[model samples]
Target: MLASLAMVGLSLMAFLSNSFGQERKIDQIYLDLDKKYRIPEQWTVLPFELEDPYKRIKNGPPLVNVVNKAKVEWISRWIANPKKVVPNAKMPDLGLNFEEIKAVIVYLSSIADKEVPQVAWDAFLLKKDDELSDDEYDKMDKIYNSGKGVWGRARCTICHPIKSVGGNVGVGPDLGEITTKINRNWLYDWLKNTKSHFPDTMMAQFRFSDSEIRDIVEFIMRDTQFMPEEADEEETTEAKPEQQEIQVLTEKEFSSIRKDNALAEKGRDIVEKARCFVCHDVKGIPELMPVVEKKRDNLAGFEKLLYEIRCLACHRIQEKGGTYAPNLTFVGNKIKMGWEQEFLQAPDIIRPLSQQMPKFNLIEEDAKVATEFMDKYLLNKELPQDVFKGEAPSPEIVSMGEKLFYDKGCNTCHAEGTKGGGVVGPNLATVGDRLQPAYILSHIKNPQQANPQALEPNFNLSEDELKAMVGFLVDHVKKKEEGK
Candidate 1:
């Protein structure tokens, strides 16, 4: 009923704008209505299936291969208190006793399909750094540093938050103390074939070479940042009672109980009672709760791309998907289709500090399909077409806008040119080639109205100021060659 009322309001606004041939303040109206009707930070049960991709996604990694992925000790710690291990862990502490945890570990080991692939490392590399000769340590350090460089170039932090920092894209796990959880072999294998391990992962498949993969594994394994901090023994003693020591099933202890069928059955019972299947895909477990799988067999065009890339994991479309990335409800009316298509294929840095589109290795056809769909369906009809009357703003307008740009201190957050500026907002160097003139006007007029989560403050520019600003921004295009 609320949706119908919203639609009616939108339709009425569109009719008024078209009949009078005047630009309506639709953006402000929409923002007002959205704030009033669409409550934030509250969960409500929709009557129909909204198909929120983030909701469909599992917070925990698939447990089928978890035995191979994480160490038994790490698993024990995680089950005890997930937040304690990784500050940003989505998993809750199951509150299972030591014996149950031990049984669970045994059961997991029993169900393991494959062992971690043995990568032959140099004898010195496997040895402790102190045990290694100076030459060996130097060689290891060189490889570690090289991997660190590769890590930065790949922009791993764009998706992954480390110590609750940097996952602006908001898809990856908190990998701050990753060394405590995963072994070097598992990390290497997972990096090599992430899809093979978890088919539903939103992580992009980077085209890294074998050497690069190995280097990343090395860097992650050896890096102090990835490792857990050693607890101060005196402080630890004062903090907790000795009786409160969490029981962990060591590898040796697990090896003994792993083959015990009775224990495995008990573990299965515990898992069922805990409803672990709700978050994890546990093999050899019967359907205690039946799940209806959404059919993706018939999905084509942009829908297929959306599912494959899991675009909804970051981007929000209407009431579906996530809010980590920009809202795409009216992207067609905001962005230039040509630029969007190109960006989908080979993305460039827009927001230098936070937002970055991962290189998904999308084909040209994929980009075309995505952009075409967005252009056709995702638009605001009330926004005036041909905002500048299909003509470039005069030099005077551009010059005034440029002056206002500096006077308004827009450069503090946004960079207009390459030489210097802040990285907090989108780099506006070639924004003219990217965003539509209409969007520029609307965005400048009211930033929060355009994007609820936007940090860009509304300058509340007057009509002339708004027009001039938009003109200046739209003029910031890449200069063409003289011959061209």
Candidate 2:
């Protein structure tokens, strides 16, 4: 049955390729796909406006000339054997084959030849190398090398981007422009423990020696030109007097100081005003019972239940919710019914480096109801038959797709097998099994046709490239079936 379906799909693809003799533009493909699928207007979610805290820091410091040989070498090594640099790191496998690995290595080597822009204070150290005496140069080189090692070992690239290199996943803000916004003292305190500043921050604490921390700080602070001259002088002068005069408080002294505040009354006032327990659980808040009751009442129907659970809090259905998880607006069209059923029951870890959805442990009746609703209502039944019943792609086309996959840096954001890292995009390891060929082609051509809020960028691929990419993905499904 599966083989027959495959043959039909391949034949249709061949016909479509031949019919469209002239190369089709990406926009044309998008229009055609939208005409067929007709994205449901009801599923669309509009974005809400929020206050911006970093609005004042929009402009960054001027670019500085700095190059670190150690940093470049580390990038090259990571490109070659990323797993070795960060063991057990769940990243995309760029080296799916030798050719792909070679292509990536060549790209990294080219990047190394170019001078790295200074984003941190460590760049200053590199800039001073030419002016340093032989002994001083050697010492600086040692410090730079140690710092680069610390960065690689910590897998900082997984969450942060440094210039054109590193992952694009914005789990944390890009450290590439960090020096422009913060000072060394603040950076030091942050590195020591982020939670001390922001109680709800997601950053984890790392155990490093004080010297190791200093090395990392120096490397990060390399581009210190951003700091105002007056501010620098003020900080330097104030440091000594403050350090000498400051009295250290014992644990008992701190506890006594905190006890003087009438915290219970203040807490009650804040909770009453803001309804803090609506999203967060606060102990001993009897007033929150009514809110909990209201939520329970809202979960009476399927749609209301979905809203009550805050499905949009993580999954973007029609671009309305949080972007932390994969968009599910067209999930019915993407995933098979059986697979979706199983997935909802026992969610698997697809993106190991990023957040994973917890198992809902829903009752059988609720699961069945949700599954049925998705299967019947969410499907894009109007997709062309040719998409589902097309001719298999030639081996040559599949090879072209493979080359394009790495050349275009698709693996950087979208993980396949074990090569890519970060959850900036969905895992394409089983995409072939999940998505229809026509839907895949449409998505690659223009993702907004399906979901206006999708983060997947349109590469503006020509007719041949689109066909080849789709073919490559379809072939992935075939290989999985054969256990290749």
Candidate 3:
């Protein structure tokens, strides 16, 4: 995760508050109630996911899917035959029954685009909790408890599940009653890159700003609410009107970062040349870093640090940006010395789920320029120790690596010899004689880069690991040309 503590404070208090609870059954108390209880509203439900309100679920008399034969058969059983087990939908029957209601309800609930309840929503809020102060009660009642934000903003209800309420989708673990389990900074990074902080975890990286992040932290552990009104009215009015902002300070600190404004403003024609926004936020930009983790860092230096860590917004090159690709921060730690040059000179496909990083068509010199900048200046740390060691596998080592190869289940798709896996790749029989170690290394680092449509997986391998694996493949097996 990018920043853990930031997310803790960023989560709004309402998300974690025990002030509300589900009191009555949805079916018994609200669903089966008389028409007088909720009938005044003529309803037109819309899916929350539709970006534009006008483009909601197609308003019509209602349509149903009939793709599967079993579904077609199941609906037929109760529609015409009229089974006793069918349920009722409360709408006056033009011939509708319980089974149709059951079928419709199940279908509607499964769709991501669905509407919030229009009636009895206020009554449901009263059921969230028994004890509550007047102040807390008033604030809680102002907005929809559904947890879906008005616009595109992140909502605690979107990520965290609260009892039977909220999106109730647990993409991340339930923070339901567990705030103390996380540290402040750790929470911030978790919101930044949950999978990185705890590899292969279920959290999605939410790019939020520092202030909103802080507000969430307070809501989760301390104040438990975001009442901008709670601040002193006079100071709130003035609101730290400082001329020297965080954005200015960060640009000065990390001046080497490549920017369109910095060069193009100087007649370098660099203004819109780089699609920097895709990866780098470049500060003072609200469209970037729209949401904060609400746990770690404050929203104070957002404009400044946007350029400082411009890599994380959407494209992760190393660990700086979004996790759309490899953590680009420590890329040097994983690759061999020559492999970087090849990868940059000719871009290759890497991750399977994503579009291949397009080749910038950098003539050798420019490729060298970017590669050197990344290696020497961009990453101001020691290169990965022993990452470039080219291990030449011997018969015994190849034999040993073979066990690890099969044990790790490498043969599912990649076959070796006369056993295991389907044959899809150039057989490794003569791989040792044809390909150079650097080429193999580059392919392993970013599979898509090697062959655009290659079915090869992006193992995200360290140079040392790729060397060992390649040595085993090249030396132990040999591929022959078709006619040779």
Candidate 4:
């Protein structure tokens, strides 16, 4: 089988490196081979080992380091979905060979700024290749100079803006801060043969000669300025100390910025820089946002996405979702704001559902923003006086609703305050105090209207039946609250 052959190859490589002789190049070559198969470079560089990945860093190493937790999870996922990655790749039936896993394990176990596991790995591990030479350095300016022509003529400027002066598609990530976070050699490798890094990363590999690549890299690395001509002007001005004396003094004298939500904001900057909204939903707002695709037709687009996602598939807000998720309509009252903020930064499996929740790999700040957003918008607001204006619905209505709540299988998915409903939906311990009457009214009128084609049944109640149901739902909360 192909898996058998791949394993043989991996074992042979392992033998060559570990048993045959201690030649490190065997490992290096294997690493390179492994590198070719990666999508999104599976490997990453982290800034620090701190709990926070989005911490503001002054400066140190030239590239980011991979977070161990992130790496392990990715490995687990790769094991689960191997065929998606390797073409004709079959190995020990686990999608990855023991040798490959072992090598990666060693890399994962080691800390950053320290020696990595593989032999002769010091250079790559330390990113020594990231350093640029004097001639290479000298050419950086030239690259910037020709950028106007190169970026302008290639149609790249049309899709990707430079200094906010070009296209609107945002097909490419912002490049202004690219130099600060990524390895220089990565840029080279990306320019030279991009697909080799991550088959999924979209940047196309242009048929660029080494000289052209150098030109492009230099243009990209000029730091603050976009034009080589402007860089010359900056250099001229910087040479005169007297001209920048006041500015320098102002910078040194500036007071440190202290804000009410400094830690949260500091985390936010990193989230925006990483641009986490490109794919996964952040869950704090009215609806989730996709990362790379846009749904543009306004109300129609919003309606289309809600219907497609089937909110009830994984979540319940009122009467929608899969039996494997949680109801979120009343989530605001249940959790502390700051805790929500922290969880968004890095979510751990607190309670596993039948299906594992997918991680968005959100940077810390994106998590914070999600936390802040949910706390602000998703919670309850009292219903209009006209709605609550009537006395609480009759006890018969409450009794009937309660009977329907069970007969219709409401408890099949929702647990009473984490009691016995299917773990798939929200716990209903405090729903009464958490949702406004109008909120419930709006949701039940058209389960699809509140959220399109919501997994919850569109009970299709007549106006009188709807009123009975609303009265029942509204009363369920108050009774539960009192019992608690």
Candidate 5:
């Protein structure tokens, strides 16, 4: 689907040899049966396989439909230097010259499964922004603004970073300059059904209506942030030196050689030599790892939810999955089941500074399944049922806690009441509704003990100070009227 390359340049060949030469010398490592056949000590025999999204051998998106997904020109630029096209791109530069890149594009085109359906756009919307009539511009702007609102509600940046910012979830690609990469048609199809393009993708399948999808598409296409920034004229003139311009494969040029079998075979050979199959599912090359087919027909409850939603893509449980989100190994003992279920259905801003959970548009049944799974299995025995002994703390203790909270500068990171604070930690305005009193007390006592990665500091407060702080935080619950 993406462009191809043949030979590594001399410099790159030398670099790769130097970097991997030691491993190449050790053929014995592969031949040693003891090392090859030995079961990993960290691995455990399970009743059934739990799909780890992070552990996929083919890390890049499948190339079977890349020809339809990306433009030949964009693919050429990406193959040349991925980071130059998108700043956070993970694909390393293969150092392919122009001719090899063209052949690869031709090869990708030959393997395409189907044509990309063309999307109908308004005539005025296709016009350049500067060329648009005032009336047409206003109409386009209205749609763009509506799309912006939808983008905000969906919290696209929770996973996807835009311009090197707001990818706290750390799973999605940098979407900044995405406008230069894919066409509106591919984007529209992907948003409509991501699993169809990449079945193993971790992105949530949001239940967006057709109009919502269109609006989002408009915003993404029209937004300046998604487009690459133009270089300054003076800076370009004052640059140290002009490098040789790399030729990009045009659609016209690619179409000419697209059906050439000899060229495609040569491209395939180059791909095999470059080991492109290590990261991508190249059509002709044998996959380095066998694909594990998963059956979802009989899956029900949490197990089904995990695969469908790909929760482990962001979250970790019992040391498996990703660490981009909160560890759920002890979630049962940490959060109130009622709040957990409600949050799963309609997630709110718990952590304003960190990555907030995206609204998955879950049904009541989905929420029930998730909460039930956590409550039954995700527990920490050391955590008490209630640190307050089944009773609310006295008003005096809460008042004292409030003073201690501010005195210790807890508000520097956490927000409380009507006043906003630092966005470094979870907002404490409704902490009582979400967290169990016991977990809060325990966490505050030793932040590192609760979460080794937590930035929360240990104040080493006296027992009374600890109790007072917990009392104050617990009092931050929503009022009865506000709960509605």
Candidate 6:
């Protein structure tokens, strides 16, 4: 019996050694590919471990993190057929031969633990009928699949994730593990009336019926294998501090909130008359077909120029326009007047990485008119006074902020001086001189409020942390001037 046990141990050791050798071979192939293609880190698909799946695990000697065979096959197909997998991926041809691709796929597949469920990719389509009776399960499945069209048409995948699929457009939180994070009833309520929970969210109201909403919730939760203990209905119903208090408003109070004034009415009329909805979706205006085919012929000067240049095609105002450019609704309150004028005239790239905004080549006269129009109409008049009244940061505070800046991974997205760490976000060296203190504070707290399409995530900083970050950003100009 002792001899047999010893032999079993030896066999296990040999198996592990062979596994390690195979993994090393795979790593060598990856290294070769990396050297040849100079592939971006985002493009690199790593082996997924069943336990602690989200965290990136370093490649172990015996390949601890197993890659599913299905995932490997999916990835192989994705690389070969980019148009099918990721239609919008602007990747250059990898120039890899079929043999090289196959080898890599085989290597990836070798790491997979066959015991694990094949639900990493295409998990969204999964309908675990075993959870319910046959008849009820069929009914739910039909109802759930019926809402798939709505999901695609709404571009829900653009901002959300369902296992390995979907783009992280960064407009909303990842919904991949949402079932584990949030309760079904709460999710249902949120789907029905998002504004009630998050008053300033950019998520548009989906006019789905009760049955459709239920179906969607079911579909989202179907593949959730591990539900957290914290995902209680009571906990989900509890509002965050930032969320507005739930209250029943009288007609007068509701009217007060709406605040229909002459200036706003005039602006609405002008926007409607100009047929801005053709290229824009202004917040308050009802959707209508253009009255005239040759609308540009009737308008002249700045109005005509605005439409001619197709400003609405890029820039958004009041959450109503294309998402490619920055929201200009509250730009007047955020940017200094002089800086805005200068930017309009010169049109230099504020964020070197972003190529969305091109040089307009506008003459001084037109630039000035545009600047004045933005300043006058798009201004936020009710900005809080406290943001601008803070004393210069103490040395200790500045030191803490400096440490926190790196600790918080702010450098990953924002460039400081010449160090371009990441290109996803804008440079911050000159931000202190450009943006208002109040706007900076508000933007840091909640970026989505300032720009619906903003990719800057809310870090949920404490008040002290918020102050420290704001001080660090605001003092950057002073530090630069002092040659610190």
Q: Name the best candidate (by TM-score).
A: 5
Where in model 3 is the C-alpha error above 4 Å? Answer: 1-314, 317-319, 351-355, 377-384, 387-391, 413-484
**Which residue segments of model 1 deviate by more than 4 Å?**
1-51, 117-143, 168-171, 205-209, 231-243, 297-300, 341-346, 361-369, 418-423, 457-463, 480-484
Please list the C-alpha lDDT of all candidates, in the order they appear.
0.79, 0.53, 0.38, 0.44, 0.82, 0.54
In model 2, the Cα lDDT at residue 178 comes to 50
The TM-score obtained by model 5 is 0.84
Candidate 2 off by > 4 Å: 1-301, 304-309, 318-320, 362-367, 379-397, 418-424, 448-456, 478-484
Candidate 2 per-residue lDDT, tens place, 279-298, comes to: 33333454554222222332
Q: Which ten residues in a row have the lowest lDDT in candidate 2?
A: 58-67
Candidate 5, residues 66-160, lDDT tens digits: the string is 98998889999988888887778888889888878877877787788987777788898777799999999999999899989889878889788
Q: Give the clash count for each candidate.
A: 0, 33, 83, 29, 0, 0
Candidate 2's clash total is 33
What candidate 6 gets wrong by more than 4 Å, as runs, is 1-291, 294-302, 390-397, 418-420, 478-484
Better of 2 and 5 by lDDT: 5
Candidate ordering by lDDT (highest first): 5, 1, 6, 2, 4, 3
Q: TM-score for candidate 2, please give it.
A: 0.39
246-333 in candidate 6: lDDT tens per residue?
2222334323423334433543454456444443323344347322222234555445445444454455654445555676666777
For candidate 1, write residues 71-90 as lDDT tens digits. 88888888887888877777
Clashes by residue pair, model 5 = none
- Candidate 1: C-alpha lDDT: 0.79
